[model samples]
Target: MRAIDLETQVLAAVERIRKGEKTENDLIECKRAWPSNNKARQLAGSLNRAAGDAVIYVIGIDEKDGSIHDTSDTDILDWWSQIVGQFDQVPAEMVRHIDVPISNESVVGIAFSSDRAPYVVKTGSPKPSLEIPIREGTGTRTARRDEVLRMLAPAIRVPAATVLESNFSAVHYPPLASAENAANDYRREESVHAFGTADFFVEHDGRDLVTLPTHAMDGIIEVGDLSFTLNVTPDWFQSETKAPRKEYIDRQREAVLISGPGVVPLRVDVEGLLLSHRKLLETTNSVTVRLHLGILHTSKPLVIEMELNTNPREHQLPEDLNRWSVRGK
Candidate 1:
């Protein structure tokens, strides 16, 4: 999962607990204090297998009363290590952690993606044994023979998407490089001082998340069917300058393919979006843009929406110059 998504999921889990919406089940678990090593292994294994997409294991919330508690006694790394060290067949590194603030105190929320299901936990004791635990509603138990086989065969496979960069900003300055006569009354177009880019990636392997089987990824989620749109606040801005739109269709410019176990990036450059839009500076000092990207990662059509803004005031020229112009010697 992306960092933004992880933070959102963890916070939502904490909120559900506080609201007393429901007891812990297949997707969420809570604890008032840190758990023992044995308990950590069981929770990790059960939740990892049960969560179809993702799960949040939260700390510092009373499972019984749903009251917030301080998790400052130990940091997140220590908590992660306790659970990770107990997994024998599961990929321990797939687990991610976040800190959730409540009132004046804070709680630790652990996020796990279930792309790699059927996790096996190693029990500790004289009669140590490896077991595949799964969560069924509010309780957990060892997976039956058929359940393990079902998890082994992925029912759905979709590559995960994440934002690499989402930024838009501009500077408005009086013409500085022009040498034309200032006395002319006709309106002159201003050079584009705004710059921005929206970039994101899609990964085929577990390097970015829990990996889907190579065959599964190949059979599902064709990269060629992907389409995207860049919506500008002033629609005229995009219509007037169609270079960016054309570049998107030109396959030679941006190459995205699911060739092997790797990732491909889709980038949009909007530095010159206001390049030729007449009165762009006079009409508005800022511009807003939104990207609606389409991809088939979960065997369902998924659209990722990201918005960016540009502030021309932040890029204005210094006060020493009222209007920059070339002085004819």
Candidate 2:
């Protein structure tokens, strides 16, 4: 599920609980405060095995009375580390940290899913042992032999990812496409630089955990009549790199590896203009841009579409073009 979707679900659950109404989903659990590291590990581990779909552990409200509890001071990253530190080989990207704003404060939620079941957590005294804890209807228990075998058996695998977050800014220079400036303007001119930032994460399979490598991703941008390709170059992509183990990160972060930021450079040219350069002055004030991305492992392609102003206000331009002139020497 997308982060926003998780936030919505948690907010709704919180409201329902506050009104003394029982939520229909047993996969959701509420906590008054951040559980101890040990407890946090247990809850995460159990939920990893228990959930057949998206499950979440929300913190900040009293589970019993549904009263709002304060947990704003906790660092979300630290809390995430606490959960990741518990297991040696927990399902990859098994948990995502979610922040929900409520009553002028932010609450923490942990989203978990695992198909690579038997996500065993390390527990016990001097002789630590791996235990596969499964949550069964609000209760957790050790997985039975048959259950363990079922989890271990080969299951259908579908590599996937979701756009966790994305933001972009673009401008279309209508004047540059005018027939009057055909001689002054080059065939192509850089219109928008630093197009945007995007975070993509491998979509979790409830029955099995999945990882989509960042190295296998490529993208393209289409604006008006122009199309350009984009690339995701993680540090590990370099041959001389010594970065830690690299995972195929699809814009996913934290428990999921977040690929390096990709800056989309857009060049608008007279020839690429959708309308004839002869009629460019009559073009509308805005143009639609689309970004299409594909991952080597996933069949689904990520597409983002946005509109940019062809002739922005004076303040939006880097320089006052009205005061400038393209005069022949």
- For lDDT, the strongest prediction is 2
Best by TM-score: 1
CA deviation > 4 Å runs, candidate 2: 24-26, 91-95, 126-128, 154-329
Q: Determine the backbone clash count of candidate 2.
A: 12
TM-score (C-alpha, index-matched) for candidate 1:
0.45
Instruction: Note the Cα lDDT for every prediction shown.
Output: 0.51, 0.52
Segments of candidate 1 deviating more than 4 angstroms: 125-128, 155-329
Q: Model 2, range 1-329, lDDT digits (tens) per residue?
A: 68887898889888888788986343677888876767644564454554334567788887567777788778766876776676657643545777788877767777777555667776755565777776666566777887676566554344344444443333344446566677776745434232444444444434433433444444554443645455543322233557775443322321223233322222222223232322332233444434444423333334444444433333245522211111111
Candidate 1 lDDT at 280 equals: 47
Candidate 2 versus truth, CA RMSD in Å, comes to 14.7
Model 2: which ten-residue window has the lowest total lDDT? 320-329
